[model samples]
Target: MNITLKFLLLAIFSGVVHLDTMVFGQFMFSRPIVVGPIVGYFFNSPQTGLMIGVILELMYISVIPIGIKIPPDATAATILSVVFANIRECNDLGMPMSIFFGIIFSLVYKFTDIQIRTLNNMYLSWVDTAKAEFVEKRINLLVYYGIVVSFLRTILFYLIVLPIIYFIVKNVCVLIQYCPVKENFRDIIYILPAIGVGIGIAHFMEE
Candidate 1:
């Protein structure tokens, strides 16, 4: 596949997956377990995707989005982990570093998510002020508008983030290659799942 076309597809995928979080039914298609592998598959790295996804799933099992409260961006983290780990430039960055970057990316991604939500709310307030007779139609229009805006927002964000993050991770990978600790990084990734599982199980522990 052409490099430009590959990026276009990934951008579209990011937008579509984001919809499952709220713009569409929360069927969990955006969840790490699902999004990770699908994204990995697109990159011809299904195993890498699933591994990252499962780890992220365990890490974020309790982060349910409710009301106006913002949750951590698990989908962003998982997708990014898979993307970074499998990228040609980041091939030596290791999964642990990829996942580390992904987690950070997810946190940073929340700011953009907030901006979109705030913008949407501002528009929603306008819709509430529409004349009575056409209010219903206006709301319906707003719903469609919100979906498109939300979708485009993610794609644009992905386009901006992908290269920047890739560049940083690639450089970091080069700098860390000769570090003694780098040899043991794989062990950390191996241990993360256990820690993640503990975190997840603790969420359900009765007092």
Candidate 2:
């Protein structure tokens, strides 16, 4: 598949996962372990996707959303990481850098989530106004508007972040060619999943 088309599909999938949070479904499609391999499969790199997914899944396994408290946006993180890794063709390095940037993107998405919730609240206020006016159609429109707004948020995020990550990864790859890194760097990547698993086990034991 073309890179642009892959990105578009990823954006749509991320939007659906974002919608799954509240608007339509609560299925675990957004989970890192699930989304990671899926995105990787799109790039014909399911192993890369599965590796990143396992690491992220274990890392964030303990975080749970309660009421208005939002957990980190693991869905966006996993998608971005897999996309970056695939774009850079980092099969040997195991996408360690991509995973790092993915975590960063997840943090950024948390703020986006807050802003989106604020927008949703505004829409809810509009819905209330529609209710007051006794216009059922207006109320329905407002509800649908809210859902569209949520989907747009993911699309906008993709548009903004993807290019930035691409440039950074491209430059970093260029730099790595000049700098001779240790041979064990790839081995380091392999160790991350084990660490994630250990953390997950600890979390489970604590619970």
For TM-score, the strongest prediction is 1
What are the runs in model 1 whose C-alpha is more than 4 Å off?
89-93
TM-score of each: 0.93, 0.88
1-207, model 1: which lDDT tens digit per residue? Answer: 975677778989999999998789989899999999999899888988898998999999988778889998999998888888876654545688889998998887888889888877677767677888988898888989989998998898788888887888888877787678766675676787897799888999947
lDDT of 2 by residue, 1-207 (tens): 766776677788788787876677779888889999988888888998998998888888878899879988888888888888875544465387788888898889899889877866665655565645567877778778878988988888887788788778766755665557735676777788787778778888993
lDDT of 2 at 130: 60
Where does the lowest 10-residue lDDT sum fall in candidate 2? 85-94
TM-score for predicted model 1 compared with the true structure: 0.93
- Cα displacement (angstroms), candidate 2, residue 95, comes to 0.9
